[model samples]
Target: MQALRIGTWNLASGRDGSGRSADAATLRAAVAGVDVDVLAVQEVDVGQPRSHGADQPAEVAAGLGARDWRFAAAVAGTPDPFRSWTPIEPPVLRGPDQAPSGPHYGIALLSRLPVRRWSVLPLGAGRAKLPLQAPDPRTGRNRWWWFPDEPRLAIAAELGHCTVVATHLSFAPHTALRQLVRLRRWCARLPGPVVLAGDLNLVGPVPARVFGAARLVSAPSYPATAPRVQLDHVLGPAGLDPQRPGAHRLALGDHRLVTVTVHPR
Candidate 1:
């Protein structure tokens, strides 16, 4: 049986601690350390000013020694006016600094094998409004919060004999459910043997049912310090089993890299 090893990680702006930025060496080391055939990365800042206006996907792909790579920008064009965040310091680079432009953050897929086709699916028309849920520290009561706008996206690619889809869902349950419904419809049109992976932003049976995916027998992949939920996942067709499902302990980002080796029908 042939198996495909998949990995996903949120690079956290490709930055390390001490306010220093992640370089080619650092990115290369991270990917090399992971044992996966394909990688789905989120929160990747491409052509951002703080990242030295570097194309992060290209840089990481080069570092990983991957010949083919594709990126889908969530925020295409200028930065969202509502988001007023700025770079605290400039990044270290071999060349002169360039102004940041285009998508502020987006998703990317890097593969050692050739990708026959790829497409980016918008999660929703615009930012979705969702009820907030936060645990109170003192009162020990759950509080409600509302996020005005959130970016959501999914990318689908056709591999040799299967289709691979990656997405990052919203924190709100309603929003996630809606996105999941759309994802299911999209997956239905794909060929047999489909794999969906990413941060669903929700826990429990909702995700499993909406996507019609079988959860991997793996540990959780959120809050790397001490994971409490399985926010990151890789689901495959029925009867398909993940050879070895597990999570990484590295502090690469808030979310740990969830990987699975699966044998498709």
Candidate 2:
């Protein structure tokens, strides 16, 4: 049996918690700090101008020595302020070898361990516009805006020992709960010892109740600099042991990287 250190982070597209662009080295170190063998990153950029048109996943993957990784694009364009962005009709899934064209935004799975297969689940975008507390691009200060929901999706990688799933759920009132139900159905059909990790956007004790599993890893991850809520997570089977890093060494983004070690079947 193989044990793995798994981690999840909503990177906010390579931007630091202070809203500063992280250089390649800083980006690499941020991921490395978590010290995870397999990582699931959400809100990542692919060929986006804001992130300097860089493939954020590939950059950090190379830095972390992750030989295998996949970026699942949920939308075709950036969800910029005052600009409208639409979901990718079919969505785009890109591997390391593929040169992903156009600016796309989504979640990604990167692993040092080899994966036997890859799959995706579509958690459609919410219709309601919601108010969000975000940073001002010009001033790097917190601001509120009625942001429209973007497309949501999940990616799962089947390793020899276990299948790992990653995603970022919509924050709309009851939409996230509905999405979790669908995701639970999908996980039930997969192989045994399936591990789920990502930002569900559901806080308090809701995830454990909705996901139908004990939270594998836990911490206040949101608002990275001074987190007060646990929006990110890692969930696994009953017998598995969960662990967390002592603390985040860097402000990777608005959410801190949550990690745990697990024995795979």
Candidate 3:
């Protein structure tokens, strides 16, 4: 089979710090520049007031002319709908298939390649009060906000040649690791080589160690303007050949778009 370009990005509600949403034209241009075959996106808002109720998955697929896409909600309601929040949901383990119905915060996948089937898994429902830092809208003060619930999810799609899993783990290092362990076990059940992509939350050698896969791409992706740490990644099962220097960073959204090419067996 031919090689394919796959990418992962956390679109901050399809906007920048200026609180302006990019027009469809600009979004299309950005995706065109990346030239990816499959794209995994996180922090997508569905029917939320912030994103103008944009169906982010469908919008991006239309922009890229992708053949298929899927979206799964992690949280139901946005605490601060008008304002942006990092680690949007509270750190709680909700049912994998149970996201509060209606408008919510979530993740999605877009694939230009043909997808045979797909599935979703909700991991790490354990609740913890995490110290979330965000600017207060009224006071404009950067303060520590303790959020009570946070949830993580993993979505997998089986394309003709490979199975790609998209997920966003918790910001807490230990929690993220625990979810990764569950994800690994889940991926093992699928056929063919599995391509894992998304924001792992925990950076450095920890992801590589826990996943037991080759890190195909490694670059600063978070805080796009002045990225210092690598938070996004494209990982694949052992023996799958990843092209060196094929990984690239695209300037789009708050998190830089990271992509990699793998020769399909």
Candidate 4:
């Protein structure tokens, strides 16, 4: 391939900036606007009534024209204000006959390019629910809570020459650091240079160091209305062609989208 385009976004389960529900059309359009070959998405809803029972991963993949994609359910139930999520024993089913069908919520990775193979790495849920800084609906004011240290996972799509990994780490600082460390070690066993895309929950420098990557995309994606921190990232290995990053605010969601393109090694 001459160039590789990658992106990452947290869909906020199809919620608009004001925390209003976004229809499937809005969700698809927001993702399509990025125009990336590979995308890693977080806060996805599958077979959930809150998202109008739509499969978020499938919708975005269709919008992006991605031929290969997978959604790993970190939690297998409707986790809402009235309830909490429980972790799946093994997010990836053991065999072809047993894929997860839900009322579940988790992360997803989609690719327009042909994938040689796909894999998932589970990052277990953090033990405690911690205070997090985020947006307050359309007001864009800072809110310090309303989040859980949810179960996490990394999904990789090997596109022959390079592998693109998608993940959302825990909000707890130490747990997120440990998860990033594990993910970096896991990538070491993959075939070639790897590009990781996701909302790592850690600030820029920490994830870069842990993943052994050069932070290419530097968009401050949190609090999409007026972002102050770059929680979303696109990190690539050495020998990558240099280029500026792209950040886009979507129709809805608490975070912005981050994209970057690089010449193939």
User: Which candidate number would show the highest TM-score if scored against the true structure?
Assistant: 2
Highest-scoring model, lDDT: 2
The weakest ten consecutive residues by lDDT in model 1 span: 87-96
Please, what is the whole-model Cα lDDT of each candidate in the order they appear? Answer: 0.69, 0.82, 0.75, 0.81
C-alpha RMSD (angstroms) for model 2? 2.4
- The sequence of per-residue lDDT tens digits that candidate 4 reaches over residues 161-224 is 8989999998887898899999999998887778989999998677898888899886688889
TM-score for each of the candidates: 0.79, 0.91, 0.83, 0.89
lDDT of 2: 0.82
Q: Could you tell me which residue pairs clash in candidate 1?
A: 49-100, 132-145
Cα lDDT of model 1 by residue, 151-218, tens digit: 67788778887888888777677888888899889888887687888888777555887788888645
Q: Give one digit per residue, the lDDT tens place, for model 3 in 1-265.
A: 7797888989877886554666555556666756789988988776776567666666777788888788877766765524333443333322224333557777888888888987888785445566766668678676888765456788888988889999988877778889999999999898768989998887856787799888888677767877778888888876667764233444347777888889768
Clashes of each: 2, 0, 6, 0
Q: Which stretches of candidate 2 lie over 4 Å from their true place?
A: 83-85, 133-144, 244-249
Measured by TM-score, how close is model 3 to the native structure? 0.83
